[model samples]
Target chain A: MQQALQQKVQKAASAIAQECFAMRVRYLNRSLTSIYDEVFRPLSITASQVNMLVAIITQQTLSPSELGGILNIEKSTLSRNLDRMRKAGWVEIDSSQPGRSHTVQASEKGQALLLNILPLWQKAQETTCTLLGSERSKAIREVADHARSEIMKT
Target chain B: MQQALQQKVQKAASAIAQECFAMRVRYLNRSLTSIYDEVFRPLSITASQVNMLVAIITQQTLSPSELGGILNIEKSTLSRNLDRMRKAGWVEIDSSQPGRSHTVQASEKGQALLLNILPLWQKAQETTCTLLGSERSKAIREVADHARSEIMKT
Candidate 1:
């Protein structure tokens, strides 16, 4: 029975390694994030942070939940990142807004940081595009769009 | 000059929101990871930990660097995860080997955890596959393979 269980587990492991969608997406995510992170290292900001800054600045202001929805970040994770960004002067909260939850917006420093990040981000983007090829790059965007739509439905 | 800089920054932000591959990938990664994480919550293991466990058990043993290479995890991140896994009694180190680096292997408890995780993992996998759809799912795997080959070359 023990031998049988081990064999079954091995089979399962092989299947997951070969065919799991989450595993592949996650692996690709890690690889791509590392590429961008390396390029953005001098700025002391990560790719995720850059994405957040862009979203915040573009929207002018957003409640935490709205930012979380746009980025697909969970509440706890989003809160932690926002706190870090606030400490870094990358974002500020507007508690004066008429709502139960405060709104977040990019601070002046954050806007300045994004300006500095543009050239470096372009280099990282070029590298990632080259790595993924145009076809897969397009496919990823489609998948993310699908995810967003599905998430909105719920 | 100030107006020009703001315009340029706004343009950059809009472009990134629309076309940045890293932004989309990171968003999808967060979304998909949350799906799997919610399923694996009962198991007290995360999707990432499950991935690490499978890799560890399949190889029977691997050095920290080797595991990191396979998972595309950075050294600091890998070390931190491993520390957590070790504390959880899921993996153990075998320092008996003749090398500067110690080898890591899943403990018996880890193997049992995998057995328990298989069904839960399948549920998460099916949910993710449904979310990504068949075509994008296959594309993600292909992209991951492309990334792996490129990384191996470097």
Candidate 2:
């Protein structure tokens, strides 16, 4: 069965059309993410920054490589993002390691913003979940997880 | 049941941390998107642009608003994206609406590249579906459709 399936669907072009799997997810993500992004607009922070805030808050400090792994983003991209976060006073990076990675942490301002945005995030999350229904959302998420793991492994 | 679920399991923050339906989808998207993005790196296009390529492949000359709807993205974001696409010669936008909306279409170059990338995309997609199992990928995509419909109404 595996061999047959492999033979039948073994091209990126063929899968690109079937991107409906990813497209719907992308659409919903944009919708929900845009709302949170708007809410954090006044703070000059992006929803991505919020993810950074959460990570720093939980770990107190993490090296960029570790942060990249946890964030599942490329190190270069993470470095660039952290550069912006550091400039915004949302986080700090210790770049003493010219060749090696260093630790990163949220700033005082960043931590405060997290507390401030917690309720807003909660409200938005609650509303969307309610609309999605817990059972339905859970099932969708489970499938998404399986999909993510499968794609990442390859 | 909806109301009860909301009350019983309205765990948005925890969900984002522990398990959010969108995270896996978003993760898979980011991962899959990054692969294509990296593949097209020499062309200097991002995953989002490759995604727009898919949009152009699907429809006739589209206005920003039309692309926004099909992509489930906002017009403002679409505006910037279309501008980039136009500049890159990947798309051409015609003022079909006479000051209202513009029609968009892929260029010769874009079509050629699409055909060029087909083989690479095939390998990526095939590997992913195989990793996920054909039945699992198919089942998950069906559920994604349901979730997308649910979100569109929301």
Candidate 3:
């Protein structure tokens, strides 16, 4: 009986060590970010910067808070990154409302850069898909969508 | 000829705006972190901190750099997180090497905390799995491993 109880405790401990969704995601994020970053290096943009650009381009325009919601990024992180993008002339922020939230859009320069990097971006995407396989790539996207919606339900 | 080339460019631009590995992973990370963070809030530990504890417990002992590599975490991030873990009385640092690197291990309190939080952690894991589904949960782990190995190749 004591041995069985000890084995259960051992199993619990191991489970705590192994089944970590956050860590797994973070590691995946880091690895994929590195691969994309390398591809974007010549363009002097990080994978993160491109992500923001893509969000702005796809949405046409978004308030910082709205972008945060869609990206599942922290408000502060979104603001900070936007600042960098604005400095880089990749994003334009309209603060005409003063106290109200600001609108963000991809500047012409950002659009041009996105176009210029398309081939490289495609290569990176292809490599990532090849590495992860189509099944996992699709599953990751679907799971990301489902998990984000579940978290936002609160 | 010019118009046809422009059309192709436009399609490529749109593709870049839609499929992004880094963005997808970041959203997944943020969502999973939020879920795990909420569950571990009562214990005053974030999902990330628990993840570190798990690594330390499973490894028994590991140097800072080794742990960082194993976790696919950046060196600076690992250092910062370890500082917090050490302060929380959940991790111990052997700084015997003085100016050099140090070994880390989960403290006794950390072990007890792990046991205490096992049920809650399991709930968080199960909830995340249900939200993402079993197939996705397993696939994420596999993809993470594959991506990490790919990143480490160079």
Candidate 4:
């Protein structure tokens, strides 16, 4: 019976490994993330952090909740990232608004980092585009847009 | 001068937000991971863990480095995950092989969990396909394949 179960599991696992969409998505994610992360390593910032910095700077000032929503990050994860960015002096609490709610704005240092990041980001982008090809790149954008719209509906 | 620099950063940030492939891939990854994660929450496992488990079980016994290569995971990250799985009794260290090389295999409990995860995984897959649409799902597969091929080349 034990041998039979192992065989069953082996068969099922093979199928899952070959066909699971989430698995493929995750593998692709790790691959792409590594590519961008490696490129951004010299800047001492991750691709995810760069995304957050861009979002935070673009808005000028927004509450953590708003930033989380924009980034589709969970509250706890958002808080953690915010804390790290704050420690890095990339973001500051906006105290101008009087209330219990706190907001964040990119620090001057963060803005400078963003400017410096542009060229490196472009290099990463070019590498990714060349790897995935133009067709796949377009497809990724469409799928991402579809996922974003679905999030909005919820 | 500061104002001009800020304007330049803002403009650059805006472009990055809309055009960056890495950002879009990350967003889609987060969205899809959340979907699978929520579906598997009751199982007390994550989509990522499920993928790892499947890979481990299929391979029967492999060194940590081999598993990391298969999953494209960093050594530290892979070790941390293996520790968690070991503590949870989902996998076991195989000491039968001699030499300094250590190998890992899914325990009976892990095999059982994989069986239980199948139906819930199917549900998550269906939801993802519906959200992404048929065309986009195909696109995702193609892009993921392309990424995998690139990794193999490297």
Instruction: List iRMS (one decimal) for every candidate.
Output: 1.7, 7.2, 3.6, 1.6
**Pairs of colliding residues, candidate 3:** none
What TM-score does each of the candidates earn?
0.92, 0.73, 0.85, 0.92
User: By DockQ, highest first, what's the ranking?
Assistant: 4, 1, 3, 2
lDDT of 1 by residue, A1-154 (tens): 3898888878878877887777777888888888899999999998888989999989978899999888878888888998999999999988785768989998878888888998898898889888878887788888888888888887
Score residue A121 of candidate 4 by CA lDDT.
Answer: 92
DockQ per candidate, 2 decimals? 0.67, 0.21, 0.51, 0.74
Residue pairs of candidate 1 with colliding backbone atoms: none
DockQ of 4: 0.74
Give lDDT tens digits, candidate 4, residues A16-75: 787777888788788888889998999899999999999998998999988888889988
- Residues A1-154 of candidate 2 have per-residue lDDT tens digits of 2555333323333456565344544666676676667766777777777776676656667898877766577888888998988898888888887867688987767766665666666666676677566765666566656655554463
Deviating ranges (above 4 Å) for candidate 4: A2-4, A95-99, B1-3, B96-99
lDDT per residue (tens digit) for residues B1-154 in model 1:
3888778778888888888888877887888888888999998998899889988988888999999989889889999999999999999987676777989998888888888888888898888878778777787788878878888777
- Which pairs of residues collide in model 2? A11-B122, A12-B121, A12-B122, A12-B123, A13-B122, B61-B103, B61-B104, B62-B103, B62-B104
Model 2's C-alpha root-mean-square deviation from the true structure amounts to 8.1
Measured by lDDT, the strongest candidate is 4
Which regions of candidate 2 deviate over 4 angstroms? A1-25, A42-44, A95-100, A143-154, B1-16, B20-25, B39-46, B131-136, B151-154
lDDT of 4 by residue, B1-154 (tens): 3778878998999999888888888888888898899999998999889999999999988998899988899999998999999998999987567776689999889999998988898898899899988888878888887778777777
For all candidates listed, what's the TM-score of chain B alone?
0.91, 0.75, 0.86, 0.91
lDDT of each: 0.86, 0.65, 0.81, 0.88
